[model samples]
Target: MGRDAPAAPRMAAPAAAHAAPAVGDADRRRARDIHVAIVGGGGTGAAILHDLTQRGLRCTLFERGELTSGTTGRHHGQLHSGARYAVGDTDIARECMEEVTILRRIAAESIEMNYGLFIALDDDDVDYTAAFERACSESGIPNRRLSTTDALRHEPGMNPNARHAVMVPDGTIDAYRLPLQFLATARAGGATIRTFCEVTGIDSSDGRVSGLTVRDYRSGRDERIAADVVINAAGPWAGSVAALAGVGLPITPAPGTMVAVKGRLCNMVVSHLHPPGDGDIIVPQRNLSIVGSTQWKVDDPDAIRTPPDDILRLLDRARELVPAFAGAEFHAAWTAVRPLSGRTDAGGRELSRNFQVIAHASDGAAGLFSVTGGKATVLRAMGEAVADDVCRFTSLAIAGRTADTPLLAHREFFRRQERVHEPV
Candidate 1:
C-alpha cells in the first residue's frame, strides 16, 4: 500500500508553456519498449498521462465517458489548501498544501484563488478554532486568525452570531477544465486519448496483465490494446476495474451529494470550524455558491441514488453560513463517488483521505497496479506517486516533472492541432 514508496519531489517540475513538444514525435522506439495503458479519464488518469508523457513514455488512456465525467467533474471544486484535513490527516493535508502551491504556479489558469474562511458558529466552535489553527500550522498550511468583527466584515453573509473565523488559502478549481489541461499536455507530448471507451475485459497471460478489450461506448466498436503496464485510475470504480483482472481490492465507494444554489453568497470559501460534517462547506463557484457534502458508503458507484433530503438539509445548513442562502435560487444537485480504501470495520468518515497505490503483484497479478482514494487537490502529486510505482515496475528512471509542466492552457484542451491526438 502506502507503506514503502519512494518519495517524489515536493515541488513542481518546470513547465514548458510556450513550446510544448510536438505530438507524434516522441521517441517511437522508446515508447514501444514500455507501452502503458491507463484506464479512466478523470483527473487521476489525465495526471498520469501528463506524468508519463513528461517522462517521454508511450501511453494511452481510455475513458468510459467524456473526460471529467466522474468524480472529477461532480466535485465541489475546492482547490484545497489542506486546512480541511489538518486535524484529521496531517500527511494528506501537508501534501495538499504543497500540491496547491505547485498547481497555482503551474496551472494558475484553472484555479480561482478566492481563499477561504473557517467560521466559528458558536462558543464550542470557538474552542475548535484554536485547534484548527494549531493543526494547520503543524501541517505547514498558512492561515491567519481573524477576530469576529474582521470575519463578519470580510464576509457579511456569515452568521452574525458567529464567534471567530480564520483565513486559509483555499481556492476553487475548474473541475471540468483542469484535468483536460493535463490530458491536452499529454496529447501535445505524443500520448493517445480515447474517450467513450469502457474496459470490457482484462486479458492477462503468464499471471500478468497483457492487454485489454475496450468497447467504445459511443460507437460500440471493440478494440484490443496490448500494453506492458495497466494502471487503474478509475477512482470509485477502481475496485470494479481490479475485479475484472481477478484481483481483490479493499476499496469502498463513498458517495457524497452536493447542491449548488444560485448566487455567490460569499466571496470566500466558508467551512465549519468543527469536525467534518455534511453541509459544513459552502464554496463560491463562478456565480453560484455550492454546499457540499454528505458522505455514505455505497455498493456500486454508478447506482448511488441522489438523496433529495440531503439537498434540503444542505440548504438549511447553508442558511447558517449565509443568511441569503435561505432564499437563494436552486441550481443543481449531484453525487460524486469517492474512492476510499476499505477498512471493513470503519465507517465512511473514519477512513483516511490519504490515497493508496497498490501493487497487485502479490495478489497474483503483475504489471497491474491500482490507485484509489485522495482528493483532486493532490491529483498531480498522486500522479507522481503512481508514476514512481510504474517506474519501478518498468525499471525506468524517469523523474517526475508534472509539478512544473505548464499544461496546455485549460481553454485549449479541445483545440485539436495538426498532430495532437495522433494514434500511438
Candidate 2:
C-alpha cells in the first residue's frame, strides 16, 4: 500500500463491453483529436477515464507507481452506507447512500452486501441512538433499531454489555477491485492507461494547460505528451501535483492508522453508536477482522508511519465493540492518508468529508483541474462532478452516463488486451 509496491502485472485481453457498443474508428479518432491527460491511477482517476472516454474524449492516465499503490490500496475497505456521517454531515451521508446504490448495480463483484451494526456499549452510546437513527432516516439511510439480545444474536461476537443497536446497509468493498473494474471499462472504451509513468511537469501556454512531461519508470526515459486538459486526481498527493502546475490547492493529507487482527471475530461491520471517532469501526475482510483508525494531519503522505500508540489504542477500542478483539492474534497494521478538502491545523475532524473539483483557471492555470476529498463510496459521483466541470471548461457538450452504465468485472481488467503503453 506504499509508494514502493510492486509494479502492476501486465493485463491480458480487452474486457467485453458492458455499457455500450464497441467504440468505432471515427469515435476513437474524434476522441484522440481532443486529448485529456489524467494524473493519477486511483479510483477517482479510473472513474474519470471511464466517464470521459464514454463521452468520446481521448484520455491517458499517468501514475508514478503501480495503480492503487497509494491510499486506494490501503483503504479500510468499508462500503459506507452514509450512516456514519449522518449526524454531522447530512449531505455527505446522502451522497454516500446514493452512490452505494449505483455502485451495487455496476460493480457488484467488488462488494459484499453483508450489512453492518452500530452497537451502543454505554449510557452515552445508548442516549445517542435516537439522534443517530433520526439522522440516518433524514439522509434516506434505512436503519433498524434492535434490542441488546437481538443485536448479540445478529453478531454473537460483539460486546455482550451492548445496551442498544442499529442496523445500516453498510458492507465491505474490494477497494482495489472496484477501481480496476472502472479501469477495465475505460480500456474497452479506447482509453490509454500508462502505469509506472510519473508526471514531472505541467506544460502550459497563455495561462492554460498544454501537455505534460512524464518520466516512464519502466524505461527510465522522460517523454512529453500533449493534452488539452490535465486533471490531478492524486488523492493525498494532489496538493503536490497541483504545485507542479504552479497552482495552490487546499488539500490536507490526514493520515489514520488501522490494525487488523487474524480472525474474523465479527461477520458484520461493527461501529460505535455515537458520532464517528477513532477506532470505532471494525470491518471484516475475508478471514481478517480490521479495526481502525486514529486521524491526524501530516505534511507528507509518504512520510507517515503506523504509530505504536495508535496500534494499542485501536485494539483497546476494538475490545469495547467486540470483546473477542483483545485476544485475536494481531495480523498487521498500516496507515492511510485521507485527502481532506481543506487545510486544517487540527486532526482534520472539523473538515467536511465532501469532495471538490477546483478548476485552476482562477489561479492562472486554466485547463488544469484538481479534485480532492471524498471517500471511495462516492467515487463515481466525484468523477461525474469533475467530468462535468471539465466539459464545461472546454465548452464540450457531453453528458455523463456512468451512473446508468454497467462496469465490466474487476478480473476482466487483467483479461483485456487494451491500449496499455509498453515502455520501450
Per residue, candidate 1 scores C-alpha lDDT tens digits across 302-341 of 9677899998998899989888998889999999999997
Please identify model 2 stretches exceeding 4 Å from their true place.
1-32, 422-424
Tens-digit lDDT track for model 2 on 62-126? 99999999899899999999999999998899999888888877777788778899999888988
* Residue 37, model 2: Cα distance from true site in angstroms: 0.7
Model 2: lDDT to the true structure:
0.87
TM-scores of the candidates are 0.92, 0.93
Model 2 residue 141 CA deviation (Å) reads: 0.7
What C-alpha lDDT, on a 0 to 100 scale, does residue 397 get in candidate 2? Answer: 63
Q: Which candidate leads in lDDT?
A: 2
TM-score of predicted structure 2? 0.93
Error of 1 at 108 (Å): 0.7
